[model samples]
Target: MKLLEVKLLTDNLSLAEKFYGKQLGFTRCHLSADELQIEMGSSVLIFRQTKEIKKPVYHFALNIPNNRLNEAIDWISAIASPLKLNSQGEIIADFRNWNAKSIYFIDPIGNIVEFIARFNLPNQSTEPFSVKSILTISEIGLVVNVVKNTVLEFADRFALDIFVPSTSTEQFAALGNDEGLFIVSEKNRHWYPTMINAQPFPLEIKFETDNNVVYNLSI
Candidate 1:
């Protein structure tokens, strides 16, 4: 299974445009009154308008170049004050982990957005991280009410291979496919979806299969 896109609901289009288009530098692939599509390399993110949505949502991560990690962090800080940052001003840069640097921010809809640069990628020397240096989306977090069932469904339907389960202190499950990785967890978990002045709930994730079949998961 390969991830092609992920869709979420937002009531504010102007804010979406500003954050994703202006701030994040994601290209506008398609747009309409009810929906807006942003391109991240080969992946797509769709934002739809909804009036009934009111629940917390999971956060997602985008991978950039390791060298540009600081640049990405600086860019994000210039636009939005980060909710959390290390002493080095990165969202997460644990050298012991993957030696990756990352920053986290909340969109207008409360979705946790991340810009990360992994150490394993080849283009780590580039400065002021450009979108082209992004290897791929490393992870999309899913904070839900159930983990086992959600993992089973993703594995059964999307062919998501479970790479890691939440530890005793962790409440997230990470799944992977050919395209990238996704993290799933319950609402009770510590990592709650960031709300953009609205409630967050289960959302749909759209992706394409190996056969080029486009499918969506509404959880």
Candidate 2:
């Protein structure tokens, strides 16, 4: 599925604005006083303010030039603090299974932001790494009480292809192609890079299929 937009809840709208606008350098189009919309390549990330959402946080990743992972990491570290593993003390990691390199960072609003470079994808940049180098949002955490059923439902409804082959969906499953992935996980489970517990916070996902069919997933 092609991710056209992702709407996430945030506790503070002003803080989210500062993080995406100033820190991440995303071009923002204010939707309203309570909402901020930032352009992430071909994708739109909408941050909606709500007092009802308790401890609003999410894990999402953006695609970057495959050869510019280190350079992009260096540039990002100057603006935001990167998340480091307590065990190895490494900020950048190699996902050999996906043939991708990734670096994690915490946004001002406490969302885990990832910048991953997939070697299998085309990297046409010979220029400097900047915010413009951020391609599309390639992944987003999908928290559900039942992982297997949710994954199957999403795939059936959206006609999304499972990018990662999984034998047991009881724990986790990633649905969709390399362009975008729903990082589905069981509720209350610990997320990667940091051991933050997952919560089924409300979020809206709008995406288009290869045939230009648009679908909305609200949870």
Write candidate 2's Cα lDDT for 1-219 as tens digits: 678899999988998887788777776556578899989888999999999876598999999999888899789989987888676788888788787889998888888889999887896589899989988889999899898788678778887766763334587788877778889889988888888888888899998877789989898
Q: Return the TM-score for each candidate structure.
A: 0.77, 0.94
Deviation in Å, model 1, residue 189 alpha carbon: 1.8
Q: Distance (Å) between predicted and true CA of 50, model 1?
A: 0.8
Give the distance in Å from residue 141's predicted Cα in candidate 2 to where it truly belongs.
Answer: 0.9
With a 3 Å backbone cut-off (N, CA, C), the pairs that clash in candidate 1 are: 55-199, 55-200, 55-201, 56-200, 110-194, 110-195, 110-196, 144-186, 144-187
RMSD (Cα, Å) for all candidates, in order, is 3.9, 1.6
Candidates' lDDT values, in order? 0.63, 0.84
Compare the candidates by TM-score and give the number of the best one: 2
Candidate 1: what lDDT?
Answer: 0.63
